[model samples]
Target chain A: MNDDEPLIRWQWIADHTAELADYTGIHLRLGLLPVLFGLIISVPLGILCHRWRWLYPPVLTVSNIMYSVPSLALFMIFVRYTGLTEQTVMIPLTLYTLSVLVPNVVDGLASVPEPVRLAATAMGFGAVRRVIQVELPIAVPVVIAGVRVAAVSSISLVAVGQLIGQGGLGYYITRGLQLDFPTPILTAIVLIMLLALATDALLVLAQRLLTPWSRNKVTSA
Target chain B: MIRFDAVSKNYPNGTTAVDELSLELAEGGITVLVGPSGCGKTTTLRMINRMVEPTAGTVSLRGRDIREVNAPELRRGIGYVIQHAGLFPHRTVLDNIATVPMLLGWNKKKARTRAAELLELVGLPAEMAKRYPNQLSGGQQQRVGVARALCADPPVLLMDEPFSAVDPIVRAELQAEFIRLQKELHKTIVFVTHDIDEAIKLGDNIAVFRTGGKLAQFDTPERLLAHPADDFVADFVGQDRGIRRLSFVNAAELPLRDGPVLPATAPVAQARAADEPWVLVVDEGRRPLGWASVAELADGGTLADASLTPLGHTFSLVGDSARAALDSALLSPARLAVGVDAEGAVVGVADACELSAGTTAVQAAAGEQASTEAESASSESRATVGKTSADTPGGGDR
Candidate 1:
């Protein structure tokens, strides 16, 4: 098959099926792991910042600044410190996830009604127990929404890591570009969007499962 | 029992919420803290559970300083209820009520059992246990709040405007139920309210705070109404305090006047002879059936054939207050209030004019009785006054 063949190169894709599967798997992990790790780190951090009113502004400002830093610049900064490996791509992607997630976690927890908090405290719920049992469960929907955004954005941004020789599905895009062939690039782009949608849907389903109470019409008690 | 000794809450900005308060609350009785906005009633109630710590002096439970105990531990043993119920929306009514018991480490079964019992105690149906707080009406939610606070049966309860969020009708119902429940539970309670009427209805002792957190007066509702200590207290109690005092005056001594009566079986001639403008016809049991007008009966018709006007109301001298007796007379179509015995048998009747004249004499007697009561007043006696039923006449004279 010629590298300059028409964009619908079915025979070439069929031949490289194993390689495509490997890159697809890598693409998913690169998008998903950072989200999982980011939630684990940011939710608690966000809650802590929420608990201490003075800590919120400073933490939010820092996260906002990190979020606004160009993704390519962030990736390059990680490369200088960690060298050309998966860590270079992963560390920056994870940071971006945290930047989005931390504020959502804080906002979600803050959204809990003041009366509910007072009720919990008056009923002898300790500070730690109240946060975990009452607040975190109530905040699930909002926090999960942030996770959905972070995951989709992370999946798209992982393709930029191809500049550092560590692309996931982005390997196909780079290869297509080098050979002046549009088929692989378009296929990879389409595949990336489908993957983002699938994962976003999964997060939404998880939110529904975790936050069953949010589905009801709630009036003030 | 709780005690506030020189307790004061002074904010860093130098505004005092409660100032140099010294008071002792009796065991198994309700002590209400009430006044206008920013009068520190809520602050005082919160101090009992240490939700707000006093900047100076101490709040002690059973003679031990609250500061000596851990706050969460102290609060666990002291139930707290607030306005709008402040229920956890995520939890079902059962779980919300079961909160304190669960925190105390009762097994789920036991905690839930206690919660069910409390739900019924607070007059909520058993089926409400599975419903979320948001599913309930405001009144029902307040009941759940009460049930939740009482789940662990803490000997002390602190309430801050717990029923104020409800409509007037529901508020009255809640207040009545609260009084009934207090009779059974006998928990020492500190209640906060801005409504003086509520304070009067529920409090064994009412602490009326003025602006700037000054304790203007602390007395029984009767005393507060009968003899307000200062101009501020008198104004706070309102100009209608005299009318409110009538609630404590029993009608047992009000003189009953006889009205012309005839049995339902009496002949038309006998019915006419017994009638003044209207004739009261009684059944064989001597229970009043209705009033028969002398003019309404045809010349040859029997008492049963006469057109009867329905009795507007019946008052009981045994349990009714002078206010109630007055209301009965005012509502009567014949301008007379009938007096009934325990069996609903007619005792006698008094027309509006007679009732007014009689009430003045009764009020004088009640005034004398009230003055005499101050020297030997006790909560036991006051409790009796609150639970007055037709079977147990509130007045000494019957």
Candidate 2:
């Protein structure tokens, strides 16, 4: 708290490179694993909802209600079960992704043109095969769009998990506040923002690579 | 061959799409089922492939009941083209066409090679193979649809208003291409359409269905136009049926004369001396140059120097029908239908009156032949069997 103290101590950064790398790695895992688990769970549930139609309203309602639960409160509920581990943070983050991922999965499948579906059946494709080979592939662009939103939000939300001391790079923010230092807080915020942007950019690139046909309309005869 | 024996389609909603229908579609020709919407023409076509199962009776393909076969397996063995083309937007044109072959377990290389051949067969360029369906025009997308359907070379093709989605010019082109393809392949085809003219133009035998799913008439296009079975059929066949019937008669049957046709090199005096109001001027190779009004010929110079009017159009004696001849005559400035040889040289000319007389003469001869054929056909079976047999002679000639 000296009047002569600089906003950022550059020597402190050079000295903590290894610790910074460790926290960055933890930050990515804490942020991304929930999104991965959420996707795995949502796709099948979404497909079932799409097939039955009536299943979607209830499933979406449940996911929306789960998302509305305060993330801090969810962490507290999971803390009793998992006891101050990464699981306590990840469990809540995973629940938050469902609100985005499930509807996206359902909408992605629904985006397949009706004529294309009929053509597939007429050409002797069985139901399962058609859904897997044709419907899923056509749904990629829309599904990826949802993934980008889920990923960025999940990455930013990971910092909130510092309340339980499992926050990844968020450890620096709490530590900086305790000592009244600005350097660690600013560095962590910048890194988290960078990670979210990089993940979103990668997802966009993946979508482009996967769905080159839908990138632009070609009106050539 | 497809047979719908006493077939009926009654929905749970109490609508009867097809009622007590008994139809025997001949092998190796186009049999069009035509009627207004909800008449069950599409339902009848779907039943042939078991896309719509009959509620009451059997639909047999080549004498085997279709219901006995697995629906997907049966569909794989039949080619189907629907309106809107229904192309897979995600797949490339070649991969879309390669679908059935690949489903039938064709190797990737073999499937793609066959797809390439069919792309050419459908008159699409080779470079289009790698492009997706959304990149194609409506007409081109339809060509890809046909190629995809024909990929496995299935013996039967069921088309449900396949060309109706395109513009009229494109539809005519597609129809002509369809006829040419049918000529080469000779597959048993069950085509469905709401257009009576389309049925007449492409069908060997047409089955007309009323709005209530009743079979109003099933006969050759020629016979259907000339002898509509009931007032419903007569009304459906339309009031201009006599003119439509002329499409069946060949242009060669009409007598033509070289009366007023003169070389463009001939003197204006020679054209003026002709008894006709207009003289048809021809080039040295005898190709029709233009029509020249004899009264408008100048005082001097050759017929070429005279003010010439364009010959509206010429009908081909070797290829065109009497309907085309009548159309040409009506459009011509000289009021004569100029007949042309295959080499494009002028053959002769015929006016509207002469074309009408020729049409009546051809009709009388056809009527006599049809009666004898009907008698022999009736002796072989009952009245229903006679109707089918009577269509064969006319079908073979076409």
Candidate 3:
């Protein structure tokens, strides 16, 4: 097929509209759950790891190992356990996000000025309250940088889920090769690329809302 | 009243931030902790609220063991302000000021109302309550910080270099505001600053901490200025500390004396005093006219009333510093510049003799302290002169 035409036609997508719907749905579930869950879990762990240097080595080592695993193998390892359900697809992809978030969270927390923390203590903020109110707000830019990287990777990796019984956009690539129908593969690739761009833009919007200080720093400097 | 009972702290890396420090802080007074960096002055202040736990001994507030009370509760009862104000950037100024009160379970509307009132108490406008910390100037942020500390009306306040972040003019203004607030609120205060001048200006009592956490001295500002406990304390206070002490005196206590008066139209002879040759001439309303010598007046011509010998002017010290009076008197071309009231009447004048006499009396009273201090210096100087000094040469040159 030419670059202008996908291996499969738009008519085929409309013809199997129900099948297309199932693919998009599962893809969303697989990437969305893991990234969101991983961020929530790792942020606190990062904060804890930061507070005590003694806890650092173990926490860093686990994240480093997670980063080393390739996407396809990671998905297959989880697939054997859950037997091709959406749970199998979601777990391993989400797990990939931990490595990205933990270090960034720790870095962000570490970047918070010592004077700021002492000021928090002097102003009578106890440990828990100070972290929530002072450290977290100041650390937003660094943490957002991590989330952005993790999120983009997660969206792209949704393609690997096609190896399981549930196929997402990767179905068009595999199916097109078998039948020599290039339209389906080309169209799916275009749509996936667009989806990635749109999601990244949304994250940038979220960053502005969450970290006003970062925006001020950019504008002022 | 706050008291430190031999409190000490040694960090794990073998940094002795504080040595056994014992001192009592009077209720309703500002006790300034002042010294060079790493002097453990900050460590001593932190231990009061248990920000830094002491390795030995304890700090008690109003006779209750601080360790017996819950740390949060103890902190809540003591107001604290620090550099940069540390207002949570995410929160509005109103929310920042209301932090401690909210923790104490104040209702939302009530806490917000109280926070606005506190902003005014610290001399900030009410509209500032809606602005975020980043939106405010350094001075405004500091004021909001002070407001937050006083929100719960805690009986004690702790400040750590609270005005250091702002520019000098703002720092002075904040210092003045704090002094006025101390007069009104009279909370037991432990203020930490490295500036000896600020310590002298703000402290009812000054506690100077040496490096390695030693308490060099603890005494009233007058005594600390008049008689430092040891050489280390004196050097830390600096050679110009006497000049800083000048700020302590009000401008209404010095003695005033009358000078001879002369009329504008009168011949110099009529204006001159026979005994002193030169007499200060006035315009009858007692505003100083000029000086006239008896020789010029004795010539007895209409033109002999020449005002060419105009009195060299100085600030009318009317009733302020003896030094102001003394300085004006010494530099006076008329032997004494005329002191005048708001009405421009010649109130009085002081002469150089008065200044030297007063200086001698003050020195004589302070000299008795010189002997006891000399003995302490001879012994301590031989030991510490080499060890603690980094930039300082053989100590006590001044």
Give the per-residue lDDT digits (tens) of candidate 3, residues B11-40: 899999988776777677888999999999
Instruction: State in Å the error of residue A155, model 3.
Output: 0.5
Model 2, A31-124: lDDT tens digits are 9999999999998998899999999999999999999999999999999999999999998999999999999999999999887887787788
Docking quality level of the chain pair in candidate 3 = incorrect
Q: Which residue ranges in model 2 land beyond 4 Å of their true spot?
A: A1-5, B374-398
lDDT of 1 at A172: 82
TM-score for all models, in order of appearance: 0.87, 0.94, 0.81
Please provide TM-scores computed only on chain A for all of the candidate models, following their numbering. 0.93, 0.97, 0.87
Considering every candidate listed, which one attains the maximal lDDT?
Answer: 2
Alpha carbon lDDT at A181, candidate 3: 81
Minimal lDDT window, size 10, model 1 chain B: B389-398
Cα-based lDDT at residue B147, candidate 1 = 91
What is the lDDT, from 0 to 100, of the residue B394 in candidate 2?
28
True contacts kept of 1: 0.45
Candidate 1, backbone clash total: 0
| Cα error of candidate 2 at position A25, Å | 2.2
Which lDDT tens digits does candidate 1 get at residues B1-398?
A: 58788889999998999888776777889988889999888888889888899999999898899999998888899988899788876788899999999888999999999899999999988888888876789999999999999999999999989999999999999999999999999999999999998999899878889877777777778778876767788899999887677676676777887887678888889866764777888898888888887877888856877778888878787888766777777786667788888888888888766766776776677667765674355532332211221112211111
Q: Name the better of 1 and 2 by TM-score.
A: 2
RMSD of 3: 7.3
